[model samples]
Target: MAKQKTAFVCTECGSDYRKWQGQCNDCGTWNTLSEVRLGSSGGSGAASARSSALSGRRGGFAGAVPESRLLDDIDCEDVARFTSGTGEFDRVLGGGLVPGSAILVGGSPGAGKSTLLLQTLCHLARTMPCLYVTGEESLQQVAMRARRLGLPTDQLRLMSETHLESMLAALDEHRPRVVVIDSIQVVHSDEIASAPGSVSQVRECAAALTRFAKQSGTVLLLVGHVTKDGSLAGPKVLEHMIDCSILLEGSDDSRFRTLRGQKNRFGAVNELGIFAMTDGGLREVRNPSAIFLDRSDEVAAGSAVMVVWEGTRPLLVEIQALVDESQLGNPRRVAVGLEQNRLAMLLAVLHRHGGLQVGDQDVFANVVGGVKVLETSADLALLMAIVSSFRDRVLPRDMVIFGEVGLSGEIRPVPSGQERLAEAAKHGFRRALVPKANAPKHAIPGMQVIPVGKLGEALDALEQ
Candidate 1:
């Protein structure tokens, strides 16, 4: 008999240590170390091998192994997809689910991860065999949700199981083409001694399921829980083990939800899928721009519209800013749906070069409709909105602006200039103040393009 060994693992960063420590050396978080016992792999090798072999009974590890072949020898023209009947969902999955692909969907609690997956399974069940296996929720509870959504329950099979071995047995028995695990954190393997949701248990169970999915040619959808910092919980290796990772984000009380593809092996990365939550379920928002933009004729001060590229689509979003005299010694700077640091930098540039003094004012800014403005293309619009608020002047109602501002006060060009202009034109925008480099070869019909070489030129256009 061999003496058992124990090691400490950081739940936050997944770094392991030889002994227990008060603070994690890797992530610098205090008291995140959890003890995990290491078991001998000698005697259990045969039993574990038997377990893996048995787990792959339904065409698991034995059948789906790929043979070594040259790139020229492979044929990929006939790759098939399992369409879930939802256009937005399929878009996020890179034009539908590929056979034997494992996808991990993660989000904050109440972000509607389970609801979206359930709705998808309902649609997939109509065409092919689909199973919704819930480790967190009961079968009856799932049935209630299906009834509430008015989804037909004839084709989809519901199972409530947490044990990994039993789940594999069910997979072998049913052989559904598409299967969804409500959450990966709850499912536990018998081989791991640590508790469920622990580092060792999560890693081993996710690996086992990923192997099973690859071997059986099943489209596996695993719901992952996010940490307090909005990242997927559990070991970082869990994210690397999947074929694709999708992040579902939005406010809890808001009706909007954005599905962003962070990592995709078979499809393009940074793809976006927008959905609107309703009583029936999640409905696809075909024209997301219309919802984000305020279409009223009234254009107020401190408001400007800019075209932003979310993946390949150009969306027009309204940027709002408010500047008020501060009574405190240090003026407050608050921004929602935009980075505060970026705002501070822009303010600095505005004062130094653009001749806008905002140091004495408590600055507040927000992107309308809860859409986060990550790209610097909105730089001109943000600064314009701030100036408009400070000067009590409203910008032209028919104009759209987008250009990246530099520290030296130059208006830099952004990518996809043609697409952004076309999007603005579609929305009846007649004038655009863009960077000189982004000027199109031919003028866009029904729109006047004003190319600005510097930040001051952009302000001159608004004043005129």
Candidate 2:
């Protein structure tokens, strides 16, 4: 019998090394290498058989050889998609779930990853075959939750299993149109020598399942665990294997959850979905702007409203800034749901162009309702909010602002500027401060459009 070989692997980047080292040379991460046992040189019969099954080969070429064709000559028909029974969920998946595609959903515990899938599967099972396999929870527990939620449990098939071979066999037998693996971390392959959730085990199991999905034309939904730092647990290669990767984000205490797509082959990766946790289950937020713009009637000095384009629509969110005299030698610059470095750079621009200085003050900024503002369109709103707070002046509550401020004090226009302004106007915003290039040709019915080319001009308009 040939001796089994051992190799070191980096948990961060999934790079294999011959031996363990103090740091991973590939990812530049320290102390992330772990030892993994490789299959013997001779290879066990079971391992070979499993490998053949996964690859759909029987010791030789299994199908006819392929031929290359011109890119334009190839068929370019649109792929069919079926709704996931939830509009928000479907929106994040480009339009709907496509056949023969694998999607990985990841989130921290209690973030409603399982709840959302369960609800969607239950509704979808009525139209087509669906299977729900759980490796973490018992069948009784899942049934109890389904009963409590008043879901249509009769159509959805449930199975409790962890062995990869058995799960694959069940998939073959049931032949469901849609299959949900409660989680990939808990599923272990019989051929692997390592424990479940290990780097090797996760890689092999996911590869096998994805291959099956591709061949069988099944919509595969995988639930993935997240590390403490809020990234998907397991090898980074797992993300590369799937067609789409989405993250469900929210604190356990918060009722609102945000689903953001990190990667997608069929849809836009920048799409954002909003859901509210309730006794029934996760319900979609049709009008997210209203929920995110919920503010008190009394006007505040540091509060400002901004229109941000998210995915296919526009969102109205409130931006707040507080500037106070520094109590310590080094003034603290903190940002919640916003970038810290951006706040510093925006401050410098304000000082140079707008003639406002708060270098000695502690600056804190936040986006209301926990919505992360990634676009530079919020720059003008942030600057205006900071200025209002420093001067103890209250801006008009009906005013909306969205534009990008350059280092040279010029205001840059954002994409879909007219749509953003229209959305704000729909929400009853009377005044809009935007970039000159983004200004509409004709005036809106109830809104006043103020277009500014430089930072100094914006400050002048604010005074008026």
Candidate 3:
């Protein structure tokens, strides 16, 4: 018998190697290489025939030749999209789900990844043919959850299978307009001689399903498992094969979940969808700004509010900072839902420019409502919050602040500044301290626009 083919593959970057190594040469990650079996060189004739038939190729170079055309020759018409019966889900998908698109949704266990998809597919089944294929759960289990969630069970089709060939056969028989595989990790292909969730199995199964979706114009929704590090648990190549990649994130303590698009070919990747996990199911949070800004009645010293632009809309989030006397020689600088490096740099800027020394204090920063602030627009608000904590003074409760503080203490403008200010004003913010360039020419009604150009100027405005 011929020797079975084997190759070492890197789980981090999907780099292939002939032999096992301690570290991946491509991504520099240690202990991520795993052996993948590629089947025997001298397989049975039946297996070879099955492989060839599944690939739609009878023999070598037997397929029709393709012709290349100029890019201008292709149609430029917009692709049609169908709603998934969830506005937040649709918003994260750029607007709506496109026909023939392959979408991957990944999250931690109990993060409601399956629940969200079930609700969507159930609603869509009323209008169009939809299928729910589960390899991770029994059909009865899915039905029980659906019934508990109060979803309609009449039209939606359900299947429980892990074999890739059998799933494809069922797809051929059903010809559904929408199909969801409640997870890609458990599905295995017979062509690959490996257990399910292996790199080869995941790559092959996802590729085949994506190809079928493209050919049949079916909306393919794939649920994926996340690693302990909160990343998708599979070969990195799987993300490249899909049209969109979305991650559902929620902490155990919080009742809210956030859906964010990491990659999208049809829409913007920066869009965010917020959902509130209820007893019935995942309900969409239409006005996320209100929920995130749900602060207590009494204002505190170390808390301040800021406006952040999430994709097409503006979000109002609170920034909090605590400055306490350090007990150790080296002060601890911690940031939750914010970048630690940026926090340290902001502290340095405050000490140098504003003449406020916090080097001997332990500084902790947090964004309210578990919202991660990745933009520099939170700089001014963070600095103000820090100063408020240091001085033990409470900022105006109706005030909003957002601006980028540069290394030289100059405040910079962020994108969609006018809209951000308007959003804050709409939310009953009376005063605004923003970059001078971002200040609106006309005064906003029921709002005081306080534009500051320098860090010192902002500090002076806070005192007044």
Candidate 4:
């Protein structure tokens, strides 16, 4: 008789445990452990059953192990790419979609993941056959959305099914160059007794589709749902199985949606794609910096412009701060688009080094345009903005600044100073305050570069 095995698995990290627990020790997620049963016969029986299940699958590649080829005999030329026709989309993929690639995209429910994929497939269908399989939405719902979005459905095929085998069969019949699984959570294989979104089922379905895409030279795109904590739903292994992982980050009320590349096998990671949600669908933001900066005729107090390097592009984002007298016993400190803990650290530095006391004031900071600044390069600008708010002074409208701030009140140079300065110059910024180490030998045309060694000197530059 085949042995019946039971184990507790974590839905967040796929860690296995002998017993149920309140929290997942590996991932630190509470109440995510689920009990699962596994059936396994003796070695021969288990191997035979697995072989039988995979043998007849449509996406399976034929032939046994082949003779290994010498490394020198392999071709190193660029792999052929199929453009989805969206410039920003293609750029995020590091040029265009490779023929045998599998991409996983995850986002909050209304972050526009489905709509963006639909638009991409609709555009790609104009040149090649595209298939969109929806396990959550019905055929009529997808069709209605296509009509509402004014997308052409001539070459695009929609299938409202959740069975993995049936989806594979359709892939064989249609032989589409591009296939989109509108979320992998709902797709399940009959062979797996677990639920659709369970760890086992999600892992199996993703592995099957990934193998199929690679063996058939098809561009496979899988849509995934994110948990409340902003991680992809299902096992974490699902992200590891795909060729690329892209995240759509934004809020319901925000006009701009940020598409960030988390992991990529064909392109650079951390590349950003900006989009604007409109009635007509998502429109790419060509000049992202302009939208992130204040458009008022005069520069406001407590607002400072900083050049931030996001992947290959340099974006000029405004850092705004407001310091007010605290009404409560303890002062309040708040930060948006910046780390709160880092904000507290910067406040301490302002008091200890710059001698600007804000212990009794409520300090609030925000980065304009819903953009989050993660790099330490914005440290100088953030501190300056806070100081400006404290003193009620306005920074020069035509100036930009960037550099890291040390704990001992020293301003340190950041990477890519030349690139950041060049971008500022292109935007007609006349002045720049950078670290002394980052100052260029030859000044940029139409721009003055003032290199500051200490934090106090930067504050003095604001006065000038």
Better of 1 and 2 by lDDT: 2
Native-structure RMSD, model 1: 3.1
Best-to-worst lDDT order: 3, 2, 1, 4
Worst 10 residues of 2 by lDDT: 58-67
Per-residue accuracy of model 4 over 42-120 as CA lDDT, tens digit each: 8877678689768853322322334579999999999898788777787778888999899998899989988999999
lDDT of 1 at 36: 70
lDDT of the structure predicted as candidate 2: 0.92
Q: What's the lDDT for all of these models?
A: 0.88, 0.92, 0.92, 0.87
Ranking by TM-score: 2, 3, 4, 1
lDDT by residue (1-464, candidate 2, tens digit) is 77777888787888889988999888899988877777666657578888987986653211333567899998888899999988999999999999999999999999999999999999999999999999999999999989988899999999999999999999999999999999999999878898999988888899889988887889999999999999899878899889999999998778999999999999998799999999998999999999988999888899999999888889999999999999999899999988989999999999988888898999999999999989999999999999999999998999999999999999999999999999999999999999999999998999999999999999899899
Candidate 3 regions exceeding 4 Å error are: 1-5, 38-65
Top candidate (lDDT): 3
For candidate 1, report its TM-score. 0.92
Residue 52 deviation, candidate 2, in Å? 7.7
Q: Which candidate, 2 or 3, would have the higher lDDT against the true structure?
A: 3
Model 2 alpha-carbon miss at residue 294, Å: 0.7
Candidate 1: Cα lDDT at 31? 90
In model 1, what are the clashing residue pairs, if there are any? none
